[model samples]
Target: MTITYQINTPLTAKQAADIFISSGIKRPVEDLARIGRMLEHADILVTAWDGDQPVGLARAITDYAYCCYLSDLAVCREYQQQGIGKKLIATLQEHLGEESMLLLLAAPSAIDYYPQIGFEKLTSAFLIPRSK
Candidate 1:
């Protein structure tokens, strides 16, 4: 399958929600308003499309210079074992260029996946749990 990857692609809440759910990335999909705002403010959004269908999405918040937080990386369940996820990331890095450092808080299940794609483990990270 030839997936077309695009940077800063505009997506509807339904499109993003469907991708997040199918990819098992646990987001508040039922709340379209919140999801809309999330997508509205993101500085970077990379998406993979199978013609008219969205197969993957990677959303991020960045300054376009020093640091970028890849908040979400999701590929449709059927499309998961392929290189789509890695391609989404590589596209994001390409947009941010070499000087920017890309980071993400991986799902527990994905912790092992990142390192295989050149992400180094970080010991100095911390987060306050999201209360929802």
Candidate 2:
């Protein structure tokens, strides 16, 4: 499919929202302003594109040495199951180097998917659920 990957590419909120909606990924896609803010505040963005179409993406925040919190990973519905998400994570890792740890909170529906792609689930992690 000749998919291409990029780092820190300028992404519009509409494009990100479209991918989030189409990929069935849970996010605040209904609010463009929030989406724009999310993209703006992210530390890193690894995006996969087919020419001009954003097929998959990974958004992360990292200290660039100790840990990388992978906040978002999404692939278009038609683009899922093609290992694009894996490639996105791998690219993100390549950008981070081996000194950092990559971590993410998986969607309930995708609980099994991450392990198959080499993500080690942790039981000790805790979260203060969002009030919104």
Candidate 3:
């Protein structure tokens, strides 16, 4: 499959929700409005497309100079293990400044995957649980 990457591409909430569901990412896919808001507020968004199909996505909020929070990284289950996720991250990094650092909170199932793609495992991070 020939996959193309787009940065800051306009994506409808439904398209994003579909990818989230296909990739087994735990998101509120049923709440498209919330998803739309997430997209609206992200500072960077990279998407992988196989023709018209969105097979992968990476969304982040960054200061462009200091730090970045990579909130989501996902590739469709059928499209996994093919370096799409890695490419998406690489694309995201290209948009960030050299001084900026990228970080994310991986799901339990994805804890091992990030390290394989060059993310350092950090034990010093902390977060307040989100109430939804």
lDDT of 1 at 71: 96
What does candidate 2 score on TM?
Answer: 0.98
Cα-based lDDT at residue 56, candidate 3: 91
- Clash count, one per candidate: 0, 0, 0
Candidate 1: TM-score?
A: 0.97
Per-model TM against the reference: 0.97, 0.98, 0.98
lDDT of 1 at 24: 91
Candidate 3 lDDT over 1-132, as tens digits, reads 799999999899999999999999999999999999999999999999999988999999999999999999989999999999999999999889688999999999999999998999999998999999
Tens digit per residue, CA lDDT, model 2, 86-110: 9999999999999999988888999
Clashes of 2: 0
Q: What is the lDDT of residue 20 in candidate 3?
A: 95
- Score each candidate by Cα lDDT: 0.94, 0.94, 0.95
Per-residue lDDT of model 1, residues 21-109, tens digit only:
99999999999999999999999899999998999999999988799999999999999999999999999999999889998898899
